[model samples]
Target chain A: MATIITKEQQEKEKMVTLVSSDSEKFVVEQKVAEKSHVIKMVMNCCGIESPIPVRRVKGDILKSILEYCEKHSKGEAQEVMEKWDKEYMDKAEKDLVFFHDLMLASHFLHIQELVDLIAVTFAGMLKMKSPEEIRQKFNINNDLTKEQEEHIMTTFGWAFQPI
Target chain B: MEVCGVPPEQDKTKGFSINDNADLLAEILSRLDGRSLGVAACVCRLWSGVCRRDTVWEALCTRHVSGGAATARAVVAALGGYRRLYRLCMGPVLERLPPARRDEAGHVSLSLSLSLSLFSIDCYERLGGRQRSSLLFLRNTVDVS
Candidate 1:
């Protein structure tokens, strides 16, 4: 016979509030927000006296990040976390604009985990692309002179032929 | 330098200004591997400057030579401790290094091939140059070794 286990009692005992820049508020489980080092540090110092104000993070972005924190906060099996992180990153790549915005928001909110994830994804996109290709993809402008281009080629000659 | 002072004819559509999203871009680029980051440098002058920043290159080198013993020893030797090392992934570092230390007899041909392989790692690390003179010297030594 299989044994049934109840949810951990400590998980439901606390809560916190976060206020965004536009005065939008979110009620979050303290355990979930605690996954963010920034929030944890604030709570540790302030002793839950004030609601944390993450001025730059908008409601939608905060919602997604909280969803991430909540899933991750479970401290579930390692394999499960890895699988979820993978799926989250894959889902994030489909909307580059939203991902980009979230990266900005993530940085401002000092959420290291989200920031690192977005950074790695962005780096992967940059990994194989030539300068021209990068320019095209990001809608960047090419403003270097002929001399400058030559210098770049000679300096990075290895990257030229390999791929 | 007057802050926000602009001369006329500065077209806003020229492209993404480096200053506009620099922090975000830097944070993003920091996570890339060495080879990919090196390629990104070739994209343009703006990116070239950003990539040339010592921090970026250092991060690349750290990742590139993280585990391999042979590759690491060869690179540190050629570039003088990851700091002096500019770009180490090019082609010419594999040119030549005589296999036989002393004798110049029948073992010459075999030694040359070995030297060439040794040279490849260094050449690859330094980025390639059209040093035909060096290549020929390497070839001759390999042939003689």
Candidate 2:
């Protein structure tokens, strides 16, 4: 008797090549790459014949996002996946530029879950920090006029007031 | 001004700044709560503009408010914008209520105001009808205001 492999099983094991904007290539399982809705749509339309070029995402950021997608596609235990996600985000948070790139990539790729995760992480960084602190951390230049600043302060005075 | 000890490295790898990306900035700001959002609005002109958008406040209102998304939408629609609705929902209940006035004839006036009265009743009924435990917080905050 010969062992038989179904078409669905073979499809599950299919490899998709994703070429980053920097020309770095990442070969990942089709299911993992499909976690990105944009890539999924492309694969659906084009049948994943050639390497899909992610024009907007850099090599490093694309690699990190693919890692996230691959892990999430594994259907791991909830607690385990949560721990992994936390660890991944913690690493990303160490470098704001990289984190920002990852966020943009996720947004462009239409990965809703990843986008939400990055948003939550970014918001956490902004939380409890003063405007000056947030501006400095993110290299944001304050363009508000003195009057505008005063208006904001007066309007949301309670938020600025000490408990 | 730095929250973390090490300053964020200058982006030599990526030329683009996340602050310059409106969609990404909006997505991040949308995760913030009312108080945090107020603080964020003071960060920069761009941030202030993003934070002041009705969509940002709408998301915040829908998330924190009781009832379902539809109920939140209805309440927000009833009030002028998300900012006004947020203020009414989150601000002091007393401030939202109609002022008590004694008529010259020695009778307390109880004229039914249109906006606040109708809004409060609609929200109360919708929130109560949902039977969501979270709705209790909203109900507790608003009582025929």
Candidate 3:
């Protein structure tokens, strides 16, 4: 299901079509679509006629992800992008489930940059927070017993040691 | 928010999906500070297990490197406890460490890169001293010099 797409196969003006899970099709410029690692492979293989079907991702998520690819394709200034990414992620994080789906979808698409960006963002949110606070953020639960829990705290005390 | 900050316990099975399972929970705890993660561990038995794992703690340590020694020490502690490190991938930055300090008293082994940076005895001792104090393990050691 996964194939490597080398750099040589990509051309600047090629055209491609992406079909969403719902059969909604989005015709994208090959230049913008190449940003997705998966599509790059398809182009590399010269496998035309197959409308790349992204079955797991919904239409809106696909749109946003493509918007990212399109904006990034312009070779925009890094400073401008850093500012945009910050704002982009800030708004994206608000819709937790949507953000999560986008992450999984990005993973499926094998968009390395997108995956790194989203993972780093999620990782950042988790930083310096308490386990409980983290659980609250993710709506997770504590399932271990008090004695079992204490054993861990005692055994791995070094992680808690002040530097 | 409750005093503990746990969402009001609606049901035991409420948020227990594979997506929010123990592994993910552990990942979340790893991002937190030690105190908060400690407090979270105390909230319940399951949380405690995930919080205490060296893998999780090691990740937290990795995240703290830029914060200062506290972060680096935390990572070292976590690494010390790990019987088998799941995955250790260091990028180019860690790749450029100078020669390891191996002195007469301590068999210190450093990459050639460190030899270039040794200006003072203090730096030399600190570089070599760590080897005398502990063993340094590198997956792939390159001679930079």
Candidate 4:
């Protein structure tokens, strides 16, 4: 006799439909989708039946986030996960534009772990770097007047001194 | 609140996304050591505002501050905030500093004391007419020191 799967079993294995801002649809496991607090809340409020829209995040960024969520939700070994996360971030950081988008998307989605990962990576880049080096890395323009910068440096000069 | 009272003296880059957002910027800046954070503050006016946040300095205080949390420190915190409090506390530990930094440590230590004296000056300001005298006294004292 053939085994008949119950409706409850099908519901138990239900996938969530995530629609990105650019109209890209991703059908992922509910566990993977719930990695984002915003998506989880939406699923709860709307009963997970309708396709949820992640409007602030574009397709490529949302896809990357979902990849991370899927990998993390798998309950892999710590070493494996750590290595994977490191490789993922290494790849992401190469393109500053992509990294910025990733950071914003994770932040908007309220994915604490992903945001922390991005923060740690950026902090690692900043560690022990001089002000000029930091400016070059981020391509930032100094907006302070020479006088203001000089004054603040003198006032808090000790902090800038190499340890 | 305004970050600085002055207009930009240079052509400002309208850096968007992570750079423009304080919460994201602080997430990265807060993890940095004092030297890196200080460097970041010098990066731009926006970074200075985030980098000087009391919460950022409070995290550093928890890490670097030894001994008990004193009530006296709270008084300094009330007036100048935790960054100032951390600066006052971190003035010592000559062993970790470079020779140039040792000189700066001494200079900052002196300034910290001068700022502390400003508290006494504040009390005198409350007592009336002596405000100008105290201000003059502080100016002269700072100049002399």
Clash count, predicted structure 3: 16
Q: Please list the C-alpha lDDT of all candidates, in the order they appear.
A: 0.63, 0.74, 0.58, 0.73
Runs in model 3 deviating more than 4 A are A1-13, A156-163, B1-145
Q: Each prediction's DockQ?
A: 0.30, 0.36, 0.18, 0.31
**Candidate scoring better on TM-score of 2 and 4:** 2
What's each prediction's TM-score? 0.65, 0.75, 0.57, 0.70
B1-145: candidate 2 lDDT, tens digit per residue: 7665443355532465667788789989998867788899898888888987888877765554333456446656664677665554443332334434211112211211222354465566665675343232542444576
Indicate whether candidate 2 or candidate 4 has the larger DockQ. Answer: 2
Task: Give the candidates in order of DockQ, highest first.
Answer: 2, 4, 1, 3
Interface RMSD of 3: 5.7
- lDDT, candidate 3, at B73: 43
| Reference-based lDDT, residue B76, model 1 | 52
Q: What is the TM-score of chain B alone in each candidate?
A: 0.35, 0.51, 0.37, 0.45
| lDDT of candidate 4 over A1-163, digit per residue (tens) | 1234666656655788889999999999898999999998898888667789888898999999999999999999999999999999999897677788899899999999999999889888887777788887777777889997997798668876644
Candidate 3: tens digits of C-alpha lDDT, residues A1-163: 1233433345323667888887888888887888888878877796645678878778888988998888889999999998888888898877677777677777778787886787667766765665577667766667666777667677544345542
Candidates ranked by lDDT:
2, 4, 1, 3
| Model 1 spans with C-alpha error above 4 angstroms | A1-13, B1-19, B64-86, B89-145
Stretches > 4 Å off in candidate 4: A1-3, A7-13, B1-17, B63-80, B90-145
Candidate with the larger lDDT of 1 and 4 = 4
Using TM-score as the measure, the top candidate is: 2
